[model samples]
Target: MRMALFSLVATVMALGASPAIAQEREQVKLVFEHALPNVEGKRMDAVLVSYPPGSKSLPHRHAASAFIYAYVLSGAIRSQVGNDPTQVYHAGEGFYETPGAHHRISENASDTEPASLLAVFVVDSKDGALTIPDKDATPK
Candidate 1:
């Protein structure tokens, strides 16, 4: 009888541990981080983004939201902010977006390598959709 009880306890423990293991695997792979200011007595949503090399996003902006900060991880990326010259960011480097500024253009600098980024956006809620303001603009 004692042996059967011990086996049941062991099985229960194994089942309980399975979910913890799966949760660990779901951890965010952060590449960038930023937060916006309070508007209308509310804080905007923070933004985070991750990408591999050779990845490029369409020209876009966050309406009623703004980028608080941007960070690069793992590899290098290039960003063009408005008419400013394009800048290259290596691992562990980043920049901030001005309020209402056009969402900058981003692209992987290395053709065969991978890169990542984390961007924090200040929106109405902690979990809000990121608005892409201008999708038609060409990448410079």
Candidate 2:
């Protein structure tokens, strides 16, 4: 009986930890990309970020040459860029991040409802990844 009780406690602890692990991850999909004919050596890319309830992305920065505009598509998102205070943006609201800005916060504002955003980036044609994780930084 004691062994069974210990097993039950362990199971409970494992279940409790699952949400935190799940919250540390988000889904990202590249929706569009195109090279600009008028703008020399520049390209435009659009990515969709989806956050499940309680989920968040790790701290990160964009390509040094990228300027980003983010629009909330559904639900609400909480975000903070560089040294700015955190802000919550609802559906139809949007914000921009200048080149080389650090994205300190990106997450769903609601614990029960999922959220999503579309990120439009104008970057140098040679730039690689759109987002780069910060060294020594973790999801909040």
Candidate 3:
């Protein structure tokens, strides 16, 4: 995770990347709440992801050993992980993502509504590149 932080800092330091970063900052809000070492020598990380109306995420994948559980907190979220059918989840609903599964779709279900979800990841403590964006994956 330190490497991910450093990479983000380095990206912001690059003048050419700052503009893109600013735009991303305006689109999503990610709150890293905690990180704890699990008994099995892995790590558990928790984050709250918030999206504004009409917001969607670019295709990405977590680490090879990262398993994720996401629970909707408000509004509605439409998501497709791996080869699963795209589905809409409302508040109090949830879904799970297996390790390395592609996050194919993640967006607010309504164009006029916002959405939020709590995501918890169980992964190796040493995994630094937690999220890997798929450059070739086009947005739908």
Candidate 4:
């Protein structure tokens, strides 16, 4: 009887310890408006990204050869690309991300203010989606 109870407890523990267990998922919501194929079979994807007060996006990268252009639409955002210095951008300002560059930091400039940006990506039509999160990143 005791052995059976131990086996049940072990089973429960194993089930609960699975890496795929449903926990809250971390995500970045990019509001893309349109995508169109252009010359040389490259496509353009236009997106609007919002960072709420105190919110941040994890370090990530784009497709193998995707170029990104980001324009601030409202509030202010702090970002760093690859090994460059971090900068804060306000409304109407813009930045660019080179293909294969590491997006090191992306967050609101202020904890009290929300920020948003329009991101446009130019990539090969068959390159699939634009962004890919860096799974090996360390927490900020």
lDDT of 1 by residue, 44-120 (tens): 33333434445666666664545456666457778887778889998778787875676567766765665555555
lDDT by candidate, in order shown: 0.53, 0.80, 0.68, 0.68
Q: What is the TM-score of each candidate against the true structure?
A: 0.60, 0.82, 0.73, 0.73
Per residue, candidate 3 scores C-alpha lDDT tens digits across 1-140 of 65754443343324221112212211433344345643555776655666667777788899888998887777898999988999999987889999879998887786676666767687887788767779896645
Q: What digit string (tens of lDDT, one per residue) describes model 4 on residues 80-133?
A: 999999999997789999899999888878666566666777787788767777
| Model 1 quality (TM-score) | 0.60
Best by lDDT: 2
Give the Å shift of residue 133 in candidate 1.
Answer: 5.1
- Model 1 per-residue lDDT at 22: 15
Query: After superposition on all CA atoms, how large is the RMSD of candidate 4?
Result: 17.0
Better of 1 and 2 by lDDT: 2
Q: Return the lDDT, model 3, position 8.
A: 38
Greater lDDT among 1 and 4 belongs to 4
